[model samples]
Target: MKDTFSSAAAARQAAQSEMQKVDRGAATLSQALGLGRPHLMPQAAVTVEGFKPEIDSEDWLVKSVEHTLGDGGFTTHIELERQGDGNARDQEDVEDLVNDPKK
Candidate 1:
């Protein structure tokens, strides 16, 4: 995709923002919910609680919410993703570009 921003800074910011979105969307995560999270919704930010593993506790950007009712009663599921280091160099590039557009 491509766009024409009104200014150089706007173009830089748009590129940076797109990179961030790609970073966050690089992985798909799913969490089965027990209770106490009925309010979870798509596009919300969530953090792991209940002393999960450090990696499991990283903040997530909510992608979707699912609810199911079966013989076991009701259950909720959350599909999430997180910003990743997949674009570390891209980040540095954005920084360098912002700091020195001539680069």
Candidate 2:
């Protein structure tokens, strides 16, 4: 026996496949930028359930949206600026501190 499905279902499946392909391309681009993997990117964070960042200004949200949709998906910052302020904790540093016997 043969199975049959509606054209709409086929179209939906095709669209989903195309979207996955695009997401793969985006992930590849993201990794090439020294941004680690796509899952580590800002957009991935935004996808997490219960993840909501409360920026004080609409300007910040607009800037964020722009970055997510724009090439590189991030603002062009120099090495120094990208490192951020000295007072901010680095994830690696925190992990090292937690695991170190000396700490």
Candidate 3:
């Protein structure tokens, strides 16, 4: 019937429009994440070390944290350093530096 044919055509058009919207959104997201262009060199494997945290050990102290964003995606690297000898003054200084409210 002509009604049935028109209904099928309308459904196809709606599906196509939805697909176009999805494609545009994907393209925008890829560009925003810096993946629109090809990378000159393939991304290297991410290496992580010293992630274990011990409640009683000094290994819980965070030495530094680094973040890298590229075509591959975002990667976070955290380095844990052992606490120095139980010196109260040094520990206080380190705590102050690490827990700076302004930072």
Candidate 4:
């Protein structure tokens, strides 16, 4: 009975140690990724045009950038612009500018 209890205690200790290591690794990764810790992560703080749909799209873009850049190397900035109506050429010009890689 004594041996059994000691063995169980040792196993528990080992498990706890491993868990601590995993937690540390997670924290390191989170820091490297430019993300705040779980409870205090930084938010984008942007004004979305279409709240529901736009938020989803923004989330997707962020995730994609995260995947592509590994961690803390990516950021997204959203700007709201108001262009007057009856401006087809202006709209097309803006669209082309957005599509172009070097604008």
**Which 10 consecutive residues of model 2 have the lowest summed lDDT?**
57-66
> Lowest lDDT 10-mer window, candidate 1?
83-92
lDDT tens readout by residue for model 4, 1-103: 1122234446444444444343332211111224422222233222233445633333211111122233554443222222112232354444443344244
Tell me how many residue pairs clash in candidate 3.
0
Residue range 6-83, candidate 2, lDDT tens digits: 554454344444444433332211112233233332322212122234221111101112123256554422110011
Q: Is candidate 1 or candidate 3 better by lDDT?
A: 1
Flag regions of model 3 displaced more than 4 Å.
1-59, 84-103
The candidate that wins on lDDT is 1
**Which has the better TM-score: candidate 1, or candidate 4?**
1
lDDT of 1 at 81: 84
> Which regions of candidate 4 fall more than 4 Å away from where they truly are?
1-6, 29-103
Two-way lDDT contest, 2 vs 3, winner: 3
Query: lDDT per prediction?
Result: 0.71, 0.29, 0.35, 0.31
Looking at candidate 1, what is the lDDT of residue 92?
A: 67
Ranking by lDDT: 1, 3, 4, 2
How are the candidates ranked when ordered by TM-score, highest leading? 1, 3, 2, 4
Task: Report the lDDT of model 3 for residue 19.
Answer: 41
Show model 1 residue runs off by greater than 4 Å.
50-57, 83-87, 90-92, 95-103
For 1-103, candidate 1 gives per-residue lDDT tens digits of 2565577678677667767787787666788877536778888887766655864667688898988787767889989888543464566677666556555
